[model samples]
Each structure stands twice: as C-alpha cells, then as structure tokens.
Target: MGSPVGLWVCLWHLSLLLLSWVGSAASGDCKGQRTVLRTFPGFVSDGPGNYSVNGNCEWLIEAPNSNYRVLLRFLFMDTECTYDYLFVYDGDSYSDRLLASLSGSSLPPTLEATSGKVPRTGHG
Candidate 1:
C-alpha cells in the first residue's frame, strides 16, 4: 500500500509512458527521427519504418545549408489519392500556406523551398 501522493506519482509516470507509446505507435516515429528537422537526404515513410502504414506522419526537413535551397525529389510514391495524401507546407506549420498536395501512384516533380532557414513539414 502506498500513500495518495505516491499513487498519484505512479499514475503520472504511467501516463507519461503511455503518451510516449501513443506518439510512437500512432505516428510511427519510434526512432524519433522526427524529433529533429532533417538536413538533407532524408527518406521518410509512414509510422514504424519503410512500407509501414495505416497511420499518419509529419516529416520536417530544413535546408542543408544556409546558402542552399531545398529541392525535394520524390523517387517513388504509391498511396491512396483520396484517403492518403502527402501535403507539403512552405513553412513549418500548415496554416494558410501549402506548397503541394500529392497522392496516387505517380511521382511528383521536385520541389523547392526558401533558403532562409525556414523549415517545411510534410504531412502524409
């Protein structure tokens, strides 16, 4: 038996762990790759790992250098156009600015973003 404070602390720790698990399980960034904005040569996929699916993910990547702009090339993409779509935002967040909305089985053309250290988030 533990005191009320002790029980509350245990519950708090459990809740924290559950939150972490949900974040990983739902978004599939178990490796915490999304924890930091990408520099370059980033290979993004749905939750878990490559070919992983059934969930949503947000991939944030920034320019490789301060002087170079970001050119994103999608080598391959096969998704459900209506249900599963990849959205590119010019800025870090998705608000009043959308760079591109891609879906279906075709590869999209290369994309460029500002080089002012502005970040971009890809919601898939």
Candidate 2:
C-alpha cells in the first residue's frame, strides 16, 4: 500500500510526463519547413539579399490581382536592416511596388520564424 500523498505525487509526475510527450510530438510535426518567395516574375524586386538577420523569409499571399504583403522578421542579429518594398510577378515580367518594410536592429537569443498564407482572388 502507498500513502495518499505519494499517490498524488505520482499522479502529478505522470501528468507532467504526458504533457511533455504531447508537446514534443507537436513540435516534431514542424520538421519540414516551407520556403519563402524571394523573387517572382511580374512583381518588382523586394530587395537585394536576405535582409533578415536570423529569421527565415516567408511569402504572404492576400488576394489575387489585389494587394499583397510579405511578413518578414529578424532573428538574433544586431544588424539594422529594412524590408524596403515588395515586387510581384506576372508570369513574364516583374514590377517593383514600394511599400513599408519591417526592420529590426537586434533580436533575442531564441527566435523562431513562421509564415502563413491568405487566399487571394484573380490569381491564376
């Protein structure tokens, strides 16, 4: 026979272990990462190089033939960088669309990057 307090402690430990396992499994699902569209045809040039210090680049699609925006963030670098503008492709050529950009001078030690998509209209 075990004491009530001991049983309670065992139950708490089991719960913690289960929660940890679930968290690990959820993180494992994110093994394969997606690529961001750095360049396109019709759209203009967004910038020169990978401006993001640490974080990865991502493509944000809003609406087809409508306005779209790219969400970028910096990671653990102290370099001051600017997103400047965005460019969209039209199969053949690319046009430069000037817009506001996100910049970060410094970032924390642990920074994770993620991207999401939005459905757009008029796009083929």
Candidate 3:
C-alpha cells in the first residue's frame, strides 16, 4: 500500500488539477432566469450560440393536465465536468427530491417526475 503522506500529496494535486479546468470562459451574458412551462410540448435553453460561464437558469415544467406527469428528454449536453451541473428535481423547488445531478459530455437518460411538477436547473 502507498504511504499515508504520499496519498495525501496525490490527493492534493488532484484537487488542484480539477479546479484549474474550471472557469476558463467569461461570464458574458449568462444571466439567471426562471421559466414556467404550462404547455405540453416545448423547448428551453440559454439562447443562441454556446452557453457562457456563470450561468444559473431554472425551468419549472408542469403537466398540461392533472392526469399526467412531466417528462424530460435531454437533446444534448456538454458542460464542464464537476464544475458545471444540471440539476433535476421531482417537484417545484430545490427542496424537493433530487432526481439527477448531471454534468460532462454524455447525454443523460430521460427523467420522469413523480408528480405533475418538475424543476430543471443548470449552473455553470
């Protein structure tokens, strides 16, 4: 086994390497906004072109009727791993049950809410 002092040094270097990969882009026009979706079929994003740094956006998707539950399908995603995240909640707020915390280049699987409400949030 590796010595305890060597293990700690390795871990410290790993943390610094991870932090260096974040914040390479400027904040730009990436502002925080909340969108409420009451329609059946819709789309949402940070707008045209590539998403900038320091973005915090939220979308509250609700089923059109009482008999249905909200479903989310990710068309595409490629955020910085560990630093940026896409958070999915089963209910209306952040205090609800967290369905997934997604990041990196891979596309996440489809998520269905337990109730009629779901919140999708993205932060960079």
Candidate 4:
C-alpha cells in the first residue's frame, strides 16, 4: 500500500483541484445588472472577469420592510490579499456596525445582520 504521507498529499492536491473547479464554474460577470443588488434574497458577484485595478464597488442590501434582516453569502472570492478588501456593514451605511472585513481567495461563511434595516457591502 502507499505510504500515509503520499496518500495525504494526493488528497490535498485533489481538494485544491476541486476548489478551483467550483470557483471557475460559479464565476461570471455581473453583466451590468442592477437588479441583482435590488432584489431581495439574491446573489452577489464580482463577475467572471478580473475587477478593475483600484476600483471601488458597493451594494446596499435591505429587506422589503424594516422588520426584516439581510443575509449574505460568498459563493466564490479571489481578491488581492491586503490590497483589495470586501467590507460588510451591519447598517445602512459605513458608519454603522462593521460585520466583516474579508479578503483572499477562500470562500467565507454566511453572514447575517444582527439588527439593521440595510446591510452594505463594499469592495475595493
């Protein structure tokens, strides 16, 4: 039988391959669509193509009424570490509670607003 170390390495490489495939498959452009941000309980993406250098983008997700909270998920993400960032705010604007400040290629876990009418998401 193969050595335990060899088996572990093989499994590691396989996992990386699977992750790459998933990211590419789910990757796509926003297609200049505004409704993706406006619609409730929808998806958010930076698109398949690489984002512009030194560019800033933001989306404000809000519930249909004040009684609801916003939920967010990151299907795939590959931003420049340290240079680029994705910021999530718990309230309607940047002045509100900071929920998460995420970066890197790994997919982050789901995020939910504690108590806010609007949850703002920004990337730069």
Candidate 5:
C-alpha cells in the first residue's frame, strides 16, 4: 500500500482542483471576467410594529473595462414585505457613476423579486 503521507498529499491536491472548479462555476459566465467586489446586508423592522425580519443581498459585477456585460441580483424578504434592489456603476470618473435601482414587495410565503443586466458599451 502507498504511504499515508503520499495519500494525504494526493488528496490535498485533488481538493484544491475541485475548489477552483467550483469557484469558477459560482461566479457565472463572463469569459472568466466576473467577480464579486463586496456585499452587505442588514435587518430592519418588518413594518410599523416592533417585529423584524431578515433578507439576502449581494453585489457582483464583471471587472470594469472587460468588454463584458454585468449582471446584478438582489433579494430581500420579510413578514411585512419583500424588496429587491439592483444598480450599475459605469463612468469615466467616480463622479459620473450611474445608478439603476429597483424594488418589489409582497406578503410572507409569496416572494417578490426582480432582476436585470447593465449592458456595457465600448464607450463609457
């Protein structure tokens, strides 16, 4: 039988390869040009009452100037209402950034959602 140390080394390498493949798949298709820069979420009061709920949020986009489109997905759900927000940032300077925001609402057990893309043109 092979040495225990040799088996462990082989397993470690295999695990690394699998992780790389999974990471690539999770980022979506963009000719290997997409990445999630940052993400933040918070809990808030469901409505006028004292009740509160949780939701999901994310921020992802293809690297700027990659000549590829950007897709942004966001979902928020709570007892009072559900909300979804999406935005795009494109400009020569930070001051010229663009923002597109969207939101949805519905009761519990019924999900309200929205999604779209921010197309990219060679000219910013």
Candidate 6:
C-alpha cells in the first residue's frame, strides 16, 4: 500500500485538478453553460462555430410589453438530433411554452412571436 503521506498528497492533487476543471467548465469558454434572461431581442448559441461536440443551451425570449412575443430564425443548423438539441420557450421561463426543439440538418422555419404587437425580433 502507498504510504499515508503519499496517499494524502495524491488526493490533494486530484482535488485541485477537479476544482480547476469545474472552474474551467464554468468559465466563459466552455459550452452547455447556463444563463437566465429577462429581456428580448437577444441571441444564444452553443459556442462559436458549428457545435463540434455534444452541448446544450436554453434560450428564453420574453418582453415586458406583454403584447410583444418572441421571433426566431435558424440561420444555420446542423446538429445530432438524436443526441443534441436546441429548445425554445415562449416566455421568460422554461414552464412557459415549448416553442420548439431544433436539431439535425434541417433549418427550422421562421418564427414570429405569437403574442404582443411589438416588431418581431429573433435570435439563434
């Protein structure tokens, strides 16, 4: 068996490595990160280019006008539908309305906000 001091040193190093990894994942450069939004006319994505790997990100489109609804357009989309997806909600929260779930190589149709009279604004 390893000596007690050696084992302790290994555990300490492992713990530090884990902490840094968690921090990096939480870093701005990581994918599938979490965020909350209270305003509209915004955009979100899995990262810079075509999603290179499995990742996820939720988007909420909400406007305070109440009369205004969210609009969305999928300019570019090619994902592993069976393993990855992009979910859209009509309101400020996930429980609001499941607008759509986009994945695969197909481009989703243009979407206009269902409620409100404000000019349509979309994000992807």
Error of 6 at 38 (Å): 6.5
What TM-score do all the candidates reach, one by one?
Answer: 0.56, 0.20, 0.70, 0.64, 0.25, 0.52
Global lDDT of model 6: 0.41
Taking the tens digit of each residue's C-alpha lDDT, what string does model 5 give over 15-123? 1001123222222212312334321121111123222123222323223333322333323322222233322344322243454333333221311111112222111
Clashing pairs in 5: none
List residue ranges in candidate 2 displaced over 4 A.
Answer: 1-56, 64-94, 105-124
For each candidate, what is the lDDT? 0.45, 0.23, 0.61, 0.51, 0.25, 0.41
By summed lDDT, which 10 consecutive residues of candidate 2 come out lowest?
A: 8-17
Segments in model 4 whose C-alpha atoms lie over 4 Å from true places: 1-36, 116-123
Ranking by lDDT: 3, 4, 1, 6, 5, 2
TM-score, candidate 1, is 0.56
RMSD of 4: 13.0
Q: lDDT of candidate 3?
A: 0.61
Q: Write the per-residue lDDT of candidate 2 for residues 1-124, one digit (tens) a residue.
A: 4443322111000010011222111111112232223222112111333333333322333222222222322222222445322222222122333222223444323111111122111110
Best-matching candidate per TM-score: 3
Q: Cα deviation in Å at residue 107, candidate 2?
A: 14
Off by more than 4 A, model 3: 1-30
lDDT of 5 at 34: 33
The digit string of per-residue lDDT tens for model 3 on 5-92 reads: 3221110000101212232111124467676776545555555455667878677776654345566766656678999888888888
Backbone clashes in each candidate structure, one number apiece? 2, 17, 0, 4, 0, 2
| Distance from true location, Cα of 59 in model 1, Å | 0.9
Superpose all Cα atoms of candidate 6 onto the true structure and report the RMSD in Å to 1 decimal: 19.9
Where is model 6 more than 4 Å wrong at Cα? 1-33, 36-42, 50-54, 115-124
- Judged by whole-model lDDT over C-alpha atoms, candidate 5 comes out at 0.25
TM-score, candidate 4, is 0.64
